[model samples]
Target: MARFNGTMVALHSPRMNGRGKLMFSRAVLLCLFLVLSSLPVADADAEQQSSEKALREHYDLQEGKRLYGEYCRFCHGEQGKGHAFNVTPPPADLTSPAVQRKSDIELAQTIHEGERGTAMGSWKWALSKEEKQYVLLYIRWLAQSR
Candidate 1:
């Protein structure tokens, strides 16, 4: 990628004529397109691999709910609202679009890893991967319904 300009520039001298320059320009553009387009395919492939890994390692949705109830319900509330706690800056409203705006990885990390120096404990050690997915699913479901 770094050397792409050098490669294209090198093509200029040998292709000085109008048609040669046009062909060279097309080739350069094609090369750039191929390089750029290849990135998305690689990214897509990585996403698929990660998703497959998650599915193979953690696909049980119910278990996630159960774990959420045991670990999160007290803080997040039965309905996933911020009402469960009486402490400062009450738990987040899982049903809120604000909360829902966060990405899955963010939610998963917050749940699995837990917030530091607060009531949120690391469920990463306590719950299985499947349970985490269920919790996330329940959170998403609650958010949508709200």
Candidate 2:
């Protein structure tokens, strides 16, 4: 038997003493402390990642609105009702069912490759892929706002 912190502890081996028991208890406590301390850090990391994603999405939408104002508003009009400029055949009313019915892929293609025989020109040389996507997002928002 060995006395550790005024408590009796039975030992089967002669090599084991109060000091060894104390060291083992300390080691266990250290391991528990390390594990518990890491939990909050992991939770904080997940929260930060979620927050970053939300902020990125919000900024992307804002950029989309800005792009629409700069590029599409002249032809599509302020509200996408079209014909802001006096172009022949007039630009398509973006909020109309005919235009909104088109899939995102089709809309993106038109933005990238231009509609033939119309005033709409290809933006492929002018805008990056991400910018095109942002424009598409703005178009969708325009439809929904109607």
Candidate 3:
């Protein structure tokens, strides 16, 4: 039977060695490693979720920026800091504690349903569910950075 010597996986399958043992062929092991790498890293600790969120979002956060510009920049301004308008009260300060304190569901609802008594418009039609998630993650990243 092929054996793992604690250094490297044996390249030969046990089937070839005629020992009747199930072996992890190098190709199978490589494929498993690659597949696992693409998936989200699971963690048991809640604190790790925040950092994992950043890592996952970092991959597509730039696309999130594009979504932001397409859906948010006009009113919320660059980075959702509300600098694009000189209007009274201005748009929502995305980085503010009040805004940042919102849960993901609240944020998504705000974006999808728009706020009452304001110029903000619902983006439910403009962005898909996944797109909304990306936007939210990007907004969170922006808030965290500042």
What are the TM-scores, per candidate, against the unseen true structure? Answer: 0.54, 0.65, 0.60
lDDT of each: 0.80, 0.90, 0.81
Clashing pairs in 2: none
Ranking the candidates on TM-score from highest down gives 2, 3, 1
Taking all chains together, the TM-score of candidate 2 against the true structure is: 0.65
Residue-by-residue lDDT tens digits, candidate 1, 70-95? 88899889889979889765778889
Question: Can you tell me which runs of candidate 1 are displaced by over 4 Å?
Answer: 1-61
What C-alpha lDDT, on a 0 to 100 scale, does residue 116 get in candidate 3? 81
RMSD of each: 10.9, 6.8, 10.9
- Best TM-score goes to which candidate? 2
Off by over 4 Å in 3: 1-56
Is candidate 1 or 3 superior in TM-score?
3
Query: Quick one: best lDDT, which candidate?
Result: 2
Candidate 3, 87-118: lDDT as tens digits: 66678999999999989999999999998877
Residue lDDT tens for model 2, 105-125: 999999999999899999999
The true-versus-predicted C-alpha distance at residue 5 of model 1, in Å, is: 58
